[model samples]
Target: MKKILLLLTLAICSWSVLHAQDDTFKKYRENAAGKLKKAENDTTNRLWKKGATLSLTVNQGSLTNWAAGGDKFSLSIAGAFSGFANYRKDRHRWDNTMELAYGYVNTTSLGGRKSDDRIDLTSKYGYQIGKSLYASALMNLRTQMANGYLYTDTSDIFVSKFFAPAYLILSPGLDYIPNDEFSLFVSPITARWVFVLDDSLANVGSYGVDTGKHVNTEYGAYLTANWNKKVTENIVFKSRLDLFSNYKHNPKNIDVYWTNMLTMKVNKYLSANVSLDMIYDDDIRVFENKNTGVLGPRLQIKQVIGVGFTAVF
Candidate 1:
């Protein structure tokens, strides 16, 4: 009788413990479900849609004790950011974007150099005026954040500095926005400002500014065309083209800026990207060889590729 009573007590304890665990699991499931439903409700009621993503990439190569010769340790780092805020309600829309990227590379032969640099911001507001036309006001700013150099045998020479060659444009225009992916804006009245904020660059009249002047102002007619599309389940493409004709100067010489990007998503946080950029400004002069004395307008082109990390919300 004593042994039987002891066995019954053990069975009762085990059953009680199992019942407690089952209750705890159900409680956790209910809590999770409630939170998910709340999140869905908040998303459905939110007025503004916004998101941001940042990515970092690093590359390194080292040479240790080896028979053959190789480069001394090389290193490179790159960071990129992209974000957007869009507000839409009742035939009104305001769209904004910010894009920034910078990169640096170091090698035994060249020491250190800026491999890539960019800063671009855009804000456009529109009100519906027709089936596909909208009255719009747009502002754009473009610049770089680091010192650019002209590398030569003697040494490196400073060609650019932070905000030393900034471009700011403002225009009230008409936009033809046929769909979510494309927009064409035309403005007959536009004001453009070119700033050389660095003292050294301003004194030397770099980036088309006159010697001893810190800023150059121009009145112009401007047009910008942009397109963004998803090519496949994992691939996306984006492109922008800018054209500006100065009304006070040589109007026929239009300044052109074009940029393109293609991104392939591997997952929610991993991606591969490629970018191309080109710029042509009539006033800005560039020398192919730094040691040479002459200067002329040079068409600039840059290309970049790397695997990246991304996040959005």
Candidate 2:
């Protein structure tokens, strides 16, 4: 009888041990699955930290005669496209963008002329300074065909040759974000150096009789305000205001340019946009006469309407 009791006790202990082991194995499996799910969720969350967009537009406009040298009525048709991609990991940020544009213009008096094509590349590195502030360093490079005109009293003349002018700008600035959709950026002071590929053009008579290659160093300030609001789930309104000034240089070279853009979604792939740009340049004549003899104070207003499509993968 004692032997029988001892065998039964042993059997019960064995069964309990087996059940405990099974429970432990099940718990471990569940824990592993939970960890895997959390990891996947973390990865998906990181995706929102990175974003990109591409935009293309065809624009047409006219330049009305207002300067000492220019056409009475000029028509311009151009196509421009730009793209940006950026990524942020925790407190470190990196971004890059590129733009390309080309166009053709016809003046009633000057005949038909092809526009200069251009390419611009920019990159930035940033560090989070606080909850709403960031310190960033930026580098921008631009190259473009020189397709300007020279105006004589008798006729409008196009440039006979093409030159590529490139420049580099390096700036370190602080950005302020008041909220998710609105922010203000101010670069209180910065140094800008403009590059001219060929000193030969500086000696060209078209720019000015006294035009020569001069190293231009300027102390400038830039401020920008951005606002974005969603009217609906698919419709959005965006506005930007930019102001720039060269305090230590010629006051006639200061400029302020602003634009307002509205975008409406027609579908998942198509959108409509209307943009208006106002430019006030103290030296508009300088840009116009960069390679010409015509000179005067000039003002410009530009309006554009277009449709665009985007695809996401």
Q: Point to the candidate with the largest lDDT.
A: 1
Model 2 residue 196 lDDT score? 42
Instruction: Please give the distance, in angstroms, between residue 271's alpha carbon in candidate 2 and its true position after superposition.
Output: 2.6
Q: For candidate 2, write residues 1-313 as lDDT tens digits.
A: 9999999999999999999999999999999999999999897676444444444444444555656665556666655555666666788766676766565767777577665355767776778899988897766665565465555668655532333234455667887766668866678676655444345554553222235763345567766576878889877787766665777756446566565667777877677777676766553344345566576556556667767664433
Tens-digit lDDT track of model 1 for 1-313:
9999999999999999999999999999999999999998786557478888788778899887856977778998889888999888777889999999999999887788889899999999999999999999999999999888877789787888778899999999999999999999999999999999988888888877889898999999999999999999889999999999999888998999999999899999998889899999988775654567678777889998888677655
Q: Estimate each model's TM-score.
A: 0.82, 0.62
Minimum summed lDDT over a 10-residue window in model 1 is located at: 285-294
How does residue 242 of candidate 1 score in lDDT?
100
lDDT of each: 0.90, 0.63
List of clashing residue pairs for candidate 1: none
User: In model 2, which runs have C-alpha deviations exceeding 4 angstroms?
Assistant: 1-80, 103-122, 141-167, 198-200, 204-210, 251-253, 281-294, 308-313
